[model samples]
Each structure stands twice: as C-alpha cells, then as structure tokens.
Target: MRPFQCLIIVALFYCPLSAAIILTPTVMPLNIDKGGFAQFVITNNATATLPLEVSVHQLLFEPDGSYQSATEPAATLMVFPPAAMIHAGQKQAFRVQWSGVSDLPASQSFFVRFAHIQLTPATMPAGLRPSDTGVNIQINYNALLHVYSDRQRADIVLRVDDEGSARLTNLGDRFTYTNRLNFEAIDSEIQSQFETVVGDQFIAPYTTLVVDAGLTLPAGEYHGREIGF
Candidate 1:
C-alpha cells in the first residue's frame, strides 16, 4: 500500500491582481477656514501601471446611522483626475477642492469611490469572442472624505468595563476621535491603577462608541479618556 500526500493552498480572493495601489491617511480632515481644500494621495505599489476611476458621492446619513447615496450632488467638493493612469512605483495626488458654497453648515461628508478602469490600447487573445473582450480584472478602493466648517470639540461621556466593551458618547456637535482613547484602571482587590494610550480613531457627532480596551479589573473600576497628538 502507498501512503497518500496532503496539500494545502492559500489564495487572495476578491483582490486586485497585481495590486500596487494604496491611498494614504485614509481618514482625511478638511478645514473650511483653510481655503476649502484637502489633498489625498494614491501610491501605485505594483510593478504594472494602475488604472482608476475616481468619483465623489454625496451622502445622506439615515436615522439609524446607515448612510445612502443622495440625489443632491456634492456641489461643494470637486475631485480632479476623474479617470487616470498611474505608472508603476509612482505616486499621484488627487486634489479635493471646494467651490465656495455660501453659508456652509457646521459639517458635510462625502464618499470618494475609486473604481477599476482597465486600459488597453491594442491587445487580443487567440479565439477571443465579443463577450470575452469585455472581460477585465476588477480592483478598487475608496476612502472617507470629510469636509467640515468647524474643528472637532468633543463633549465625551465614558463608561468602564473589565471584560466587555466600554461605551463612550459624544454629546457635542463635533465627532470624537477614537485614536485618542486613554485608559486607567483601579483593581479593587490589589488597589492598583495604570494608564494607557490609544491610537487615532473616530466617533461621529452625537454618536456612541463601544470599545474593549483589554483591561483586567476584577471587582474594580475603569476610566478611559482621549489624548490629542
């Protein structure tokens, strides 16, 4: 009898083939006082040229916090290079400009969608049919683009937990950044307290955040705060 061999395989599914495209600082902040302009950068990390279709979408946040595409155009924001190609190992900046919409509210948001656009001037495969000609690899990404008239001033309310998610609420007009969470815990049994620094994260305006800071406080209290770098 012969012994049988086993094999294991891994795959990168639903990802761009030859993907070398990346958008840095995914979370962007816009200051209307700063001339209503923000910059987003895309770096092509692949060895082949990267093609993309970039467009801006207006957002309407539902009562349940889920947002949907709005018919109202993003008249305030305009992104150039709606369609472009990036050479391998190169970087490109997409400028987001505001057309000076009058009486702008405290804040407004948009979703910048980067879609795959295949580029081929002349190429054909053997026995290619019309249906096969339309086939191309799909690779895409997007980012959260925020344009606000005011800076973030959070009125935060925090709740502590030892083994579960800690809750935080912002009662202010501005959103609280999650990356700024700090934790201090006092163990009732040992009577000890310690502090920690959390990374940059965000909580929307009038929204709540539930996070687990991995604090082991048995029969004790926990406290969390935010820090600005």
Candidate 2:
C-alpha cells in the first residue's frame, strides 16, 4: 500500500493553476456511507497574502485511459470556506461534503482545485520591498477526491501488451495506489522478473494503464499483483 498517491491523466485542463498554495493530504478518500465528508488544509507560502478560491471538478475517466474534467455544480458538493484570503505562511481549513448523491456508477472521483484569486496592488502590504515581489507569485495546487460505494474495492487486471510492456487495469471503484507492482514476463528462453513503480499514480476505477516494461517481454504467462496500497 502506498502512503500517498497522485494522478497521471493526460488531458486539456479547463482551468489554470497557480503555485502559491500547498494542500495537505494531496488525495482524499471518502466512504459514501460515513457522512461523506473530508477536509483539507490550504497553506500560503508566498510572501504576499493570497485570496484563495476552492473548487471541485468531476474527473471523467475516458476510454483511452485519460481523464476529462467537468465542473461539478456548487450544490453537488458542499465546501466550506469556499473563499478566503490567506496570509503568507498562514493556513486555512476547507471541508467537502457529499450528500444524497446516488445513481453513480459504483463510485466517482473529483479534483479539488485550490485556485488563486489575484491580489490587487491595493491589497498588497505597504511594507513590501522590491525583492518581495520577485519571490511571491501565486501558485495553485490540486487534490484528488473520491466518493465510493460500499462495494468499492480494488481489483487489478494485467495483460501483456507490446514487447516488454503490460497493461494494468483497475476494475473496482476507488483509487488503487501501489508503491510497487509484482509481475513477470518472458520472451524466447529469456525470462525476467520486473517491478513497476506506480509511484503516486492514483489509477481511477474502470481504467487501464499501459505499463512499459522497458524491455521486450515476450508473449507468455505473466503473473503478479499489487503488493500493497
């Protein structure tokens, strides 16, 4: 099991991001039955105070193993402190609550965008020095969140793709994170044991990942499983 996980989706982002904000708990895992609530802390590291805007986007997993973002309606997910002005080195708490969400396909996931609200010059500190302006630019951060059905669990499916390449698919709801993958393949009389570091890759449910073995793995019986989360 990985202690922390992130996502790797190739898509055109509908929104922009800044670099001034840092979010703890980069990923959110929720139990749809347990009040469906999760929290994240936003910290501003810039020298100037930042006006922060918190928002959520529905993550649509496409067939080609990519994700598309759809803006979730404000009423769909209740977020507290949706807007706040955070001073440099200050922290603000935000909460996301999901209620009465049904008719979902086993489960669903979204991304929380910690966007930056431009700080007007008038809002800037009077004591700002020239160096300060150069150092404190707004940087935004994003966190992945998932709301799962009670049946949400991880199911790993592997298939041999091109030479030395394999495809890993998660057939269950929720993000299946693994620090290491144990699988083997062989070509000709040469056999090799290989491990792929999935990293913080949070593979969305019902999606497939083409894992490159970096070598020519022949067509043969390949076996392994996700060692842990």
Q: Which candidate ranks first by TM-score, i.e. highest?
A: 2
Per residue, candidate 2 scores C-alpha lDDT tens digits across 114-229 of 76644455544456444666644443467778778665666666666445566767776656654444554433333232333343455667777766545455554454355654
* Clashing pairs counted in every model: 7, 13
- Cα-lDDT of candidate 2: 0.62
Q: lDDT (0-100) at residue 158 of candidate 2?
A: 66
Q: After superposing candidate 1, which stretches have Cα over 4 Å from the reference?
A: 1-18, 58-73, 100-104, 118-137, 159-166, 181-200, 211-226
- TM-score of every candidate relative to the true structure: 0.62, 0.69
Name the TM-score of candidate 1.
0.62
Candidate 1 lDDT over residue span 11-119, tens digit each: 1234343244677666676777777777778887766666777777665543223456555546667788667788778888888887765455445566676666453
